[model samples]
Target: MKFTKFTGLLFVFMAIPFLTFAQDWHVGAFLGISNYSGDLTEQRVDLKYTRPALGLLVRKDINRYLSIRGAFTWGIVAAADSTNSSKALVARNLSFRSNVFEGSLIGEFNFMDLDEKGFTPYVFVGVAGFGFDPMARDQSGNWIRLRPLGTEGQALPQYPTRQPYDLFSFSFPFGAGLKAILSDKWTLGFEIGLRPTTTDYLDDVSTNYVDQNTLLAYRGQKSVDMAYRGDEVTGKLTPGTYPADGTKRGSPDHKDWYAFSGFTITYRLGASSGWGKVKSARCPVLRP
Candidate 1:
């Protein structure tokens, strides 16, 4: 009986945030571009590979300055070493394209109350779970998935410490935006958010190269062919032209990151009870 009483109190304690039944509710869509930064990008984000992204979001305003938002986004991210300015990197000839789908729950804070000011700058921080499948075009111009091949020697007998990376990972999403009230029922916003991930294999090029012969023997010819491609560019290249086995193919110290930037438009369902201003028995007012 005592335990049950304690549990009931704990439930109510946890339910304080959701007591926001008296707040405002909003639903919206995000349309924008997405890009990635990794071994293939020399900078933080490579613009050349930017691709269209789309998302749907629902928000609940806990109060005038704070809100909770949930969103689902889909986008494309890709890059190629061939686009590098350095001949050595270009000859390395690594490339990958991946479709990323992310779902996030975030807390948003407005610097100024949009309800009173009509416009405000906002910031948000969130946690997201995202999935991506990296692919590269084969010599035949067909796209091939990269994971099962274990291009980095994952799951091979010789390197027991090298484990396969999961296709899905958790990311930290944080960014800022500007919001303006368009009307009583609508709002317009622009936001840029970045998701830094835990995995280094988003491009499937992290760590050193596996022995080409061993990779060829265990994972088959496709694995060896995709693992190293220096020969493909320079005809009749010397055997050692490929990064010799156990050499750096990518920096394991650095992880990959992807980002989304776009415009958001939201519609207000209705103001929660007691959230609106008391009219003081005054006349009609403009859309608040």
Candidate 2:
């Protein structure tokens, strides 16, 4: 009897937190710009490559200072070596564009209560999964998918370790934002979030250049054409020869990263009137 009584008490104690929390939900839309960082970019965040981004998000504020958010975002990121100021990079002449879709779950921490301060600064960190396919324009101005061509010898038997990278990857998304309570029912905010990913192929550039002869023999002429683009600027590397096997094409030491910066507008639900405080059994506490 005593053990059963103890279990009952323990359950009540565990339930107290849920019972006291004022369930507040915020559904919102995010409008933003997306940018890419990788071997192709001259700077960590190349503004020249910025593109449009859009997302929908839902948030639940557990308390005055804490919340949970889930978001789905779509964006495009691109970069070109031709934009680089360095003559060597310009001559390399490689560029790519990737349309990406991401979904994330994050925990947010607010510095001040929006109900009282009217405005607050917040930060969040979360895990996200994103999908992307890199493509580049050919000499004919048609976009060609890069993965299937195995631009780095990914499809060749000689380079067994070089396999085609997956289209999906996991990332760590973390950033900060500022929020203002526009009304009891609406809130406005702006945020900048960065996602560092597990894969390095966001731009389809990594590791060394493959043997031109081998790549042509196995993957054909198009593969050779895309792999050694210096021909476009330098007029081909001595005809039958090219940047040979093991020539430096890209740095493999680091993975790729992307960022989203933009504005958000949210509508409150599930009792927006009882925003920051714990609830009572007899009455729902209203924000003043």
Candidate 3:
């Protein structure tokens, strides 16, 4: 009971800031492109393409040099075969549209103190947690079916042949942005960012499979060869043939990272740092 209580308290402390940010959030919508650069790129996948992301920021200014900010963002991410000719790659393309949700705690640093500033420039760094889901489409435009990779080791009821929810994963976040003082109370800005994760399959390109009959049979040379076929570099396969041994199961072997940037418009509230309304310098001499 003591352990349970302690754990509950810890979770509450972590959630307090997130709850506060939701109430007085600074909402903004901006569009920018994102792409992947790790293993998925080497496996003939299109991981880099035009994508857009949107986010909201909730900030608390601590002082001239530091402050805290929380944010939430969602977007589409993909990668392409950069080595292949654009025309050829498009003809034989395999792409997944993965959705991601991320939350971050950022620290702001002012290079020029508020008192010495004409234009204040700042930098930030932070950690974040994320959730991602990858989906693929067939020639008919319907999503293709999938099962978790390596689930063969589990029992039938415990391991589904095809389940949609298996593709989600968590990640670590880091990024930097710049802010400029437009007025005593208003600021403008832009930012670039990145998130790294331990999961190798964000595109469902990893793992292999065997056809239903061969898989259930669980024996013989034919099924063995079919299952291992996914190991081939070319990934060549006949549509109706028994599943190859190398038939991929999960997301591809690639690093997941995206780049995004946009302008920020901010309105400050309070009297600190000349943010309040300027009073008239010429007040008539008080009562005679």
Candidate 4:
């Protein structure tokens, strides 16, 4: 699905639950850094490509130890094989950057009572859906969208086995956090979460390199050129030299992963009353 359509659906999903249950809500915003691990990154988490991330979240408390949250996050993730220490990766010279839009529904489990919290550590796990469009810079310095170009010969008759990847995919978000209640109405926290995605093409460099001639015929010359970018680094375009068909372009054995790490500040909404009192009153008294 298109990213815009997916985003619209996410907003609607977030709105419905909030409208239905108006009490025990905590609205917050977070600021952090984001990164990804994939083919280009080769399992190493690098800080050089870390980019700023921000998000807005809404939480509904089920109890002092349990709560559910919906959040919308935006971030940038990028990596380059050229930056790797491995000679093979440096010679491959592949790279891509993508902006990520994600919506997550997570359940948080606090280790201690959150109602009268000074500080409590928590863990969370949930499902998330995100959209991305990976882009690479061409020789002319123009950023080219990789999906339409089919750099790996995807969706072409010649390579019927290689299907095009979805622009939007699902992921599992799991992580831990620490929160400190600043007042009855305010809280501060820090969290680090990892999202393991089902898609391998987050960096647009997965699977084998297709025959350049086949890609040129099926996906055009742009596919042929982008499919094998080693020449960009070598500066020598040897005729008929390309990654042979069936050669590994990426390790298909593993999937991509992205992460968000940072701090959050939340404001409590609606004063506790009646049944809400029983829920909020379970905590030990706060010490001065």
Candidate 2 deviant stretches above 4 angstroms: 1-23, 234-241, 274-288
- The estimated TM-scores of all candidates read 0.85, 0.85, 0.60, 0.84
Estimate, for each residue in 1-288, the C-alpha lDDT of model 2 and write its tens digit.
Answer: 999999999999997765554347788999999999999987789999889999999998888899899999999999998788877777788899999999999999999988777789999899999999999989999999999999999957999999889999999999999999887788999999999999999999999998888998999999888887777764432232368799889999999999989999998864555433423334865999
Residue-wise C-alpha lDDT for candidate 4, range 1-288, written one tens digit per residue: 699999999999998876666557989998999999989875656787999999999998898799899999999999987788787887888889999999999999999987654679999999999999999998899999999999888888887888889999988999999998777778899999999999999999778888878888878887777777788785343333587888889989899999998998988876632332545657888999
Error of 1 at 41 (Å): 0.7
What do the candidate models score in CA lDDT, each in turn?
0.88, 0.88, 0.53, 0.86
Error of 1 at 134 (Å): 0.2
lDDT for 55 (candidate 1):
95
lDDT tens readout by residue for model 1, 154-194: 99999899999999998999999999888777889999999
Show model 1 residue runs off by greater than 4 Å: 1-23, 234-240, 272-288
Error of 4 at 64 (Å): 0.8
lDDT of 1: 0.88
RMSD in order of candidates: 5.9, 7.3, 9.5, 7.8
